[model samples]
Target: MALIHCPSCAKRISDKAPFCPHCQFARTDDPESLERAARIRQIKHNQSLMTHSFIALFAFVGGFALWWWGGEAADGWRAPAGIGLMSAGFVGYLITRVRIVLAKRSKG
Candidate 1:
């Protein structure tokens, strides 16, 4: 069997190992391993961003639509709703941006 690094125990374990013999870390080794682990982490992070982006896009669309409808709906309450939706989109964007910045900083 080939040798591989254990991210958990920081030990070199056998590629076929079900668990690290020295540190007892399980499912931490396998064939087709290193690339798979990196792909999994990247997919998870992308899913998180996509979810936020979807919500933000919906909010932005809703805000614009409401702003247009406000003129048609008497009393202009739709304008307020539109403003709220736009604000929500802005807040979501800011949160996402901050998270990205924090993640970058943490890497260094």
Candidate 2:
């Protein structure tokens, strides 16, 4: 219910607005909430990446270990499976990157 200055454009506007009505700046008040939301989204996105990357890393490790230990499985098979894990990790990374870009655009 009080007036606030917009961080982006330095205009006076209502504090309740998530973005400044005048110049579309972020409201100074409750910036922590916004930051927190951003962080939460980032963590979730990164966690997803971690999951995918871990799967890939583990697959690679398992394949390497088996090969190193002289396992009977074909080298080509293990290589392809490792490649699959890396592809999954790459997909996850791309997803998170898109999400971050979208979020930044939305804030504008």
Cα TM-score of candidate 1: 0.55
Worst 10 residues of 1 by lDDT: 28-37
In candidate 2, what are the lDDT values of residues 70-103, reduced to their tens digit? Answer: 6554466655665565566556556656765675
Scored against the true structure, residue 80 in model 1 reaches a CA lDDT of 83
How well is each residue in 2-46 modelled by candidate 1, as lDDT tens digits? 998764455788889887787565664355665565556555665
Deviation in angstroms for 14 in model 2? 21
Full-model lDDT for every candidate = 0.71, 0.60
- TM-score per model over all chains: 0.55, 0.37
